[model samples]
Target: MFGVLTERQAQQEERLLDEEEKIPPTSIYNLELLRECKSSRRRWKFFCVLVFILTFTSVAQLYLSLSEFKNQLLITTLNRVKSAELTKDIDIIPIHSHNDEWRRLPLYDALRVGAQSVEADVWYFDSDPDTIFVGHNKVFLSSKWNLDDMYLNPLFSLIGQNNIAKRFEDENVSTRRNGIFYNNLHQTLYLYLDIKSNSEKTMAALEDKLSPFINNEYLSYYNSETDEFVEGPVTVIITGNYPYDYIVSKSTRYFFIDAPLFKFKNDEELAKYNHSCIALASSASLYQLTESRRALAGVAGLSEAQVDTISSYIDIAHNNDIKVRIWETPSWPVRTRNEVWKQLITLGVDTLNVDDLYAATTFF
Candidate 1:
């Protein structure tokens, strides 16, 4: 019985050993899988950290670039404002050069001295109405010295070179035209067209010559139908035998008439003429003020009666928004001319019509 029990015990022990071997192999396979999973997880974590670091670096670089651009824009704006403030103001009073065509350089010399207004006496040939001439008399007329050749063409060229339209656009200004002087921005150069020939025929010729400027909007013109004056670089005022009845009848006029100051006795008469639309300025001879003063004093020596007469005319013109200009004032004798100019300035004359541009500009 003892021998049988020992054999049975030995068989049971063998079965237990087999079971232990199978369990250990299975456990080792599970351990290997677990080790592979841990290795994969560590690699994935390292990859994620690298991606995070790269993303942080890219965002930081983008922020720095944007900040630099913002600073540059601010500096450019400040410099522009500073440059504008440094430019000086051109403060010149209105000075008109009478018989400006008679000067050595018609418009150029007057412009150099800062003469805002200039006059040209123009005549059209009776035989050939198309031909216009610029001169004090017909004897001095030349085909080469025509209005367009002398004034309009050169003016157009200057305007093109200056780029006036762009400058005005930048300034946010639309009303007044740009002046010839570079420093003077908003002042329009007044061009007095003194018609010396037949009023009707000469005007037609003048229109033809001025058509280019009018078309390009370089010349100011009054639109009677709209009752609006279109401002431009040059303002043309017609004088010397201008047809008043014909001028008043027009629906639109490129030329403004020089109304006779003597005709209007009071503001009521001046208003009735509609001087604002038809005329820019009313002009008269200094002799027209009083007969006694004309015979004895001229413009230099004026009696209180003459002074009152002249003052009344100026007042009447001013009431109608029309500027006053007195022609045929004393020109000889420098002292007398200076005295007359002083008197005229004191009287608040809108423009001093002087033959000597230098004297006029230098006076004040």
Candidate 2:
């Protein structure tokens, strides 16, 4: 019985020891699960942060792009508005660039289309022996075309077909003359011719050809030799190339002064020489006036002295009932150009030289 009891006790002790040495798997599983949960939370947090940064960056870039687009649109709209306003205010049209196609337009159409002055660069090209033609440039060199064919022929034909308008009269160009064919509108044509290279003989020949036009009673002549400008009958427009002492012993209807202002010694000299002759001055020198007002006088090309020289020229001419005109100015950007125009208007500059027909229409 004792042996049996001892064996039972040993067995119980061994079972107890074994039970103490063994751990529950559920507890270990819970600890490991807790650690994994922590690691998963960390990874989720990192992913969320990365996503947030990417989303924010994307939004920022999108916003910037949209802002830039809006700014560009606004700028475009503003430019368009300014252009429209300028076009509305000015009666002139702006030809984008120099084009010979404008020559085909009727004379009256020129004014209506906003051309301040129709400029014809007259050059005689020798196509063959004894055959000369009026061409704008080297492009139109055929004998079939001449100045007469380019301008006068079309003008005469149009007027001949339409008998309602009267011929050009010297009184006021604004008036509607008979036999003048104005395209739909009653706009008159203003001719600004750049005489091509011609010698004394060629000039004489040109004069003879032009004599028929000159003899018409509807034209006006301004004799630069006499400094007498009248408004009646067609006459050869003369230049102020001679000394100022000469008076228009003969009557003339129109006059042009190519003289520079400084050519005269002083105000009195200018006054004495420019009596009763419509005058024009070069504006090539006035470009720098905007940069510095004090520097206005020193500007090159045509100095203030030259500009001031016109003061007397204008006085003498206007006092004798002649008009004064000026050439050259800031011709682009109607806004900027208008600044110059306003200044000239204040100074009583009659004609504003402009290359764009659209721009001229705006001013007139």
- The best candidate by lDDT is 1
Residue-level lDDT tens digits of model 2 in 27-97: 76898999999999999999999999999999999999998687546534433332223223335432211
lDDT on C-alpha atoms for all candidate structures? 0.74, 0.45
Question: Which residue pairs in model 1 clash with each other?
Answer: none
TM-score per prediction, in order, is 0.69, 0.46
What tens-digit string does per-residue lDDT give for candidate 1 at 233-283?
788899997877767777877888887888888556666565446878878
lDDT of 1 at 90: 32
Q: Superpose all Cα atoms of candidate 1 onto the true structure and report the RMSD in Å to 1 decimal.
A: 29.5
By TM-score, how accurate is candidate 2? Answer: 0.46
Mark the regions of model 2 whose C-alpha exceeds 4 Å error after superposition: 1-109, 114-116, 125-145, 158-190, 222-322, 332-334
